[model samples]
Target: MSSADDPKTARQPQPPSHAMVGTWRLVSYDVEVASTGERFPAMGERPTGYTIFSGEGRVWFMLTGDGRQPGDSDRDRAQLLETLIAYSGRYRIEGDVWVTAVDVAWNPAWVGTEQRRQFALDGDRLQVRTPWRVMPNWADKGETRSIITFERAVEG
Candidate 1:
């Protein structure tokens, strides 16, 4: 069976350490256009993603649009690239903010950078928000803020 079909392989929740140390399955990912206040999905409405945090300060994150199939051409490959995001690094949680000191990222520009996101935990669900930043491929249009939600992965 495909990995997507198995919850165990899709994401497994790590033992809790603080509030952020756990595997999380993406539930929703949206970005709000700063100027217009219009929210749109960052990777379509049904994006698939996972974030895993270890008690030892390590973290891994990845997200991609659903329904992506193997690409056979350059355009297809580019499309795939445009639909995905991945990064990994050490992380620290301070108060209500979590910061990731990126060691590696799909985008070279993110390497060596620190990314901060405000987060809150409500029962088994997690919500995170990014600060407003220039929109990719549409910087001139306006800034955008990413808002994502996740739920702790349940082991079968």
Candidate 2:
């Protein structure tokens, strides 16, 4: 069959929303400073996380920084919290963006917020970017955005 006639090649014109309904392994989570165009991994060079989207439109994700250790004190516990990002909620896709109406989050401030993520899917890879905002984790850096990349997790 010709390439144009192949099911995979002619399946759809727009980004498939269903393509996101699965577990994804985090590849990198970086922060880009708005003013200088400087980008760096906000969670260290080897962070770990998982983002899962249910077929029923529920989404949940938890990302933690590299080399996290059990907190031994109040200060240590606070520091641990600084390196985590987690939330869950119902979600909807609008074109290339997915907005989650967050009902729960690591930060109470995010509990009732609508988290909008601009995304692009290429084969098994997904890249997501957040709108520029001052994040409590790195508020010292001023306005910044998070750039995250994930790969579809293979099911056993």
Candidate 3:
């Protein structure tokens, strides 16, 4: 049987009111420090990623830093991992926030956690911001929040 015909792989119809249900291409990803009000790109000047929200209430996200290079040593591999964030699971929308009950994640700690993102849609652009918290990737930066933007992908 085809994957789309399977109950587990089939996507349920999304409600017309669910505006965020679609595929989006990453535009920019930045991190902001709560204390100093400093903001910088999370990956680099031109990070890349994609996020897909299905009518079946599933969401998948994979983002990578700009200019990622292959590593030759353990340290290099670790750095590569640090520059990536990926997760997938069921999600639900609440007001302007979307929460995902992550079933799998690049970081094991996020596997069972609910990740919440506050988002705003403007035309074909969607901007998302995470809550301020101490991030493992940039703990030394203190409480930081991710500010990401995505453009709705056009299906030609």
Candidates in order have lDDT scores of 0.87, 0.92, 0.92
| Tens-digit per-residue lDDT, 1-156, candidate 1 | 887789896675443379777899999999888888888787887999999988878889999986789999999988898888899988888788889999999898999999999999999999999988896755765888889999999968
Give, for candidate 1, the lowest lDDT window spanning 10 residues: 9-18
Tens digits of per-residue lDDT for model 3 on 1-156? Answer: 987788875665554348888999999999999999999988999999999998778999999999999999999999899789999999988998999999999999999999999999998999999999998788998999999999999989
> What is the model-wide C-alpha lDDT for candidate 3?
0.92
* Backbone clashes under 3 angstroms, per model: 0, 0, 0
TM-score of each: 0.84, 0.85, 0.86
> Candidate 2: worst 10 consecutive residues by lDDT?
9-18
* lDDT for position 73 in model 2: 98
Best by TM-score: 3
The root-mean-square deviation over C-alpha atoms between each candidate and the true structure, in angstroms, is 10.2, 8.3, 4.8
Give per-residue lDDT, candidate 3, residue 107.
Answer: 90
lDDT of 3 at 44: 95
